[model samples]
Target: MLRFAPSPTGDMHIGNLRAAIFNYIIAKQKGEKFLIRIEDTDFSRNIEGKDTEILSILNLFGLLWDELVYQSHNFERHRNFADYLIKHDKAFYCYCTKEFLEKKKQEALDLRIPFRYDDAWAEIQKKDNPKPVVRLRGSFEPISFYDEIKGRLEFYPNELDSFVILREDGIPTYNFACACDDMIYDISFIVRGEDHVSNTPKQILIQKSLDYQKQLGYAHLPIILGESGKKMSKRDSASSVSWLLGQGFLPQAIINYLIGMGNHTPVEIFTLKDALEWFDIANIAKSPVKFDLKRLRYVNREHLKRLNESEFSLLLQTQDITIGALGKLYLEEASTLNEIREKLGLIFSPKDIDVTYEGESFKEECLKLFEVLWGMSMQGESFIEYESFKNEAMKRSALKGKKFFKPLRILLTGESHGVDLNELYPYLRFYFKDILRIKGEK
Candidate 1:
């Protein structure tokens, strides 16, 4: 079994999405159940509907889970496990006030030592105290676990000190909630960023004290670094999955870039369906990878080329198949839907012919060329050879050279200079009526 327990906090970060993908792929490979556990117990911080947004994004990327659950729904079960530890003398309540604990923590800093819980606090009974927080009676012994990607890992006893499990208000801390739920769900393996490595030993302690015997699997990949070599922030480009999708980055491209990080693959570019065959955690790079937004654009371009005409149309948000087909012509110069839309807008948008655009020197010729084309334009929506049409228009207008091509070029492609007319016209030919005559015109 595998689970992705994300909080409904803001938009889903790129890191969490990568974690979810790794877990889903592994589960699918092993024919095991994959589950989504929305860790929404921290009601104070959770953003409403962000959970739905997360699932929808996962679906957009084709990551279908075998089961789904909310961590808050298991609140009673979490409390019960905490109680069991208390009854077994594995944990006890501490009446230390927030100010008091802060003083002790600061004192540790003064002494230049790590803050470990003062055992004396538990002995002090305060009648004024509200519901006290529960703390584990941690042992002074080394704990270790094997990580699938990182290999053998261990934590020393001095580093693993007694910590709070549940707050005075009956709210479980992250380590407590996550550990309890992992056991409750009978999860077989865990895959998350390397930042969570320290928390692994603490979670292991929770299960050991409760006599839960399952040895959980773990794979902690190196955390992604921003260009500044710091952890990702909102300032970073790839920080928000929602923002990336909104910017017209293909989900397949994002998946391709992420999967290829620190892992060997059969190909540089592949669909999610193709990844299922060659993905292996053992091949993943154990080093931190830099998230490059530029590389995503390059990958996006490759995916754009793979798209058929219908997909091109959908990418541009158009029902007109001609507009969609024309979008493909701009693919060589565009990597995103937004970019292609700009190109389509340049072409399909009714060209406003200003005879004076070329100055009075050629204004008369421009006017004559426009009249000739408009008169012969709006033909049957069938294809027309560009040379024949342009040549005849030039003959009728009695204009050639600079006078001929410039006016015709502006009329066809909204640009006075660009790819030759022969290359653009065939794909754009269907939209002649749309381009030549303004709307509400004869």
Candidate 2:
């Protein structure tokens, strides 16, 4: 069995999404039962809709699970486990206040020493005192575990603070809450990011104290870095999955890009179904993976090219990039939806033609060409005869190449270089009169 547990505190970061993907892939590969556990015990940060949003995004990527569990729903079970530890003398309650701990931590920092918990309060009894927080009575000896990815890892229990199990507010801390739920859910494999390496030992302690019979295997994937080799942040491009989706990125592209990070494969373009066939746990890379926007764009382009015409049309409609008959044509030429949107900018928001030529005085020639095109359109001609238009313009003005097409291109699309106006004539003819009425068009 495997579990993809996420806290509903904020938008699902790309790193967390990758972890979920790894877990889901392993679960499917092993034919094991998969579950999604919502760790929403932290009332302070747990937003209302974030849980739904997390599940929605997972579903969008086609990562499904067998069951859904909320960690808060098992609050009584968590308390009971803590009580069992307390009865076994494996944990104790500390009456330390926040201010007291902060001052102690600062003093340790000033002394350039580690701040291990001085659970001295366990030896004393102060009746009528404030509520106490339950703490694990960790050993002074070293504790070790074998991680599937990182291999043998060791942690000195003396160096680790006797971290809180339950707060005075009767809320279980993350380590305690997650460990209890994993035991309850019978999670056999624990896959997470490298950042959670430190927390693993603490969780192991809690798991042992609870007497979970089954052994838990762990695989901590390498951290994902930004292009600058630092941790990813919102300032980075496409850092937020929701923002990426809103920007018209297909979910398949995101999934392919993420899987490609760790997998050693010759192929760049692959679907989730293809990924399931190729996924191997041993193939996951140990080095940090860097997030590159250019690579993501390449992946997006590949996915765009794979979409059939009807699928492409539906995608455009869903994104509200409707351009009538021209949209389908643009989709054929565009490598990405963003590219289609860029090319269709003029159609969406028409601008006055900037007919200011660099030096040539070809306004008269361009005006004659427009006059001919408008007359033909007004006569119910829906298509442009490019050769005929060019011949008449050249015969009238004795101009060709850049001098001839450059000015007309600028007038047509408000730009000098873009989609060939000759091929775009069928669509641009509807806007020919509108382009001719621009203030600067001669």
Candidate 3:
């Protein structure tokens, strides 16, 4: 069984989505039970409707979990395990306040000693009338677990802390709650981000203490870094899945792009269907993957290209884009919604070009070329033959210079470079006709 545990602290970022997707793929491929567990342990940071929004987005990408569980609702289960650990001598109470711990840490630092919770742990063990926060009594030997992907990871006793399993607020910390949930849910595999590597040993310790029967497999996926090789932030790009969707990214494209990030697969372009068939946790890369905007755009364009005309039209309707204006201009050229979207910047208002090049010395010459091509049909004209027309226009108008084509290119496609003018002409013609018909109505 696989479970996706997402904390409802904020919007579902790409990192979070990747984890969910990886788990979803594994569960689907193996024909195992998959579930969603909301780890809202930090109540203060939990955002309302975040879980619902996450579920909705997951559904949009076809990442559905078989069952849903809320950590908040299982408070008693976590509390029971914490009490059991205390009774079994696996955990002890620590009453030291933050000030006392800070002072101890500073004194240790001043003396050039190992500054850790050593003093705090000793004090809590001996102190009378301890306010009592439970801590795991870690083994003094190195703990090791074989990460399915990273492989043969070991953590020394000194490196592991007597982490708090139950907070002073009586709420179980993430480590305790997660271990309990995984055990109860029979989650055979744990797939999450690489940031949780240090926490894995601690969770394993808790799992061992609880006598969990199943040996859980772990797959820690690499981080998605920004162009600067730093962790991607909300400031760096669209942080939320909803934000990306709002920005016109298709959910399947986002899913496909994410799967490519850290996972090693021969399949370059993946659909949601492809992921379900080929997802293997062992294939996930150990190295971090950088978020490349150019690569993402490429994936999006591929998805755009794959959409049939009907699907593309449905995409426009879903986005509330009225294609009436676009339809008139590119009648046959605008074969897909992607073409329409790509052509939007090219489909300009007459006033825009009217302002910039209207009275210029070469304006009349440009307009004549534009008008001739505007009403031109490809019915009898082959794309190869249209190239001949472009060459002839250049020769006849003596406007073969860069300035002439540069503005013309922009006027035709709103981009300086794209598919050749001959192939692009039909779409541009459609766009102009749409604009002209709209203007005629007024």
Give the per-residue lDDT digits (tens) of candidate 2, residues 1-442: 8998899987788888888988998898889988999988888888999999999999999999899989889999999999999999889988877777788889989999988778785434446457888998876678688888778999986657678999988889999998888888888898899889999888888888777767788889888898999988768756788888887788999999998986786687998888888877667788888888878877887787776656776776753222434555664456567677676665434444434546445556556555665565577755357666657655655567877787567556655666666766666666666655444334
What local lDDT score does residue 423 receive in model 3, on the 0 to 100 scale?
A: 55
Better candidate by lDDT, 1 or 3: 1
Candidates 2 and 3 compared: the better one by TM-score is 2
Query: Relative to the true structure, how large is the alpha-carbon lDDT of every model?
Result: 0.83, 0.77, 0.73
RMSD, one per candidate, in order: 2.8, 3.4, 5.6
lDDT of 2 at 375: 64
Off by over 4 Å in 3: 119-130, 318-342, 345-350, 357-433, 437-442
Sort the predicted structures by TM-score, highest score first: 1, 2, 3
For candidate 2, report its TM-score: 0.87
Local error of candidate 2 at residue 159 (angstroms): 3.3
Worst 10 residues of 2 by lDDT: 319-328
Across 77-187, the per-residue lDDT of candidate 3 in tens digits comes to: 898988888899888788777777799889989999886665245465345535667788876888888898899999988877687899888999998898889888888
Backbone clashes in model 2, listed as residue pairs: none
Error (Å) of candidate 1 at residue 141 is 1.2
Provide the TM-score for each candidate, comma-separated: 0.92, 0.87, 0.80
**What lDDT does candidate 1 reach at residue 361?**
44
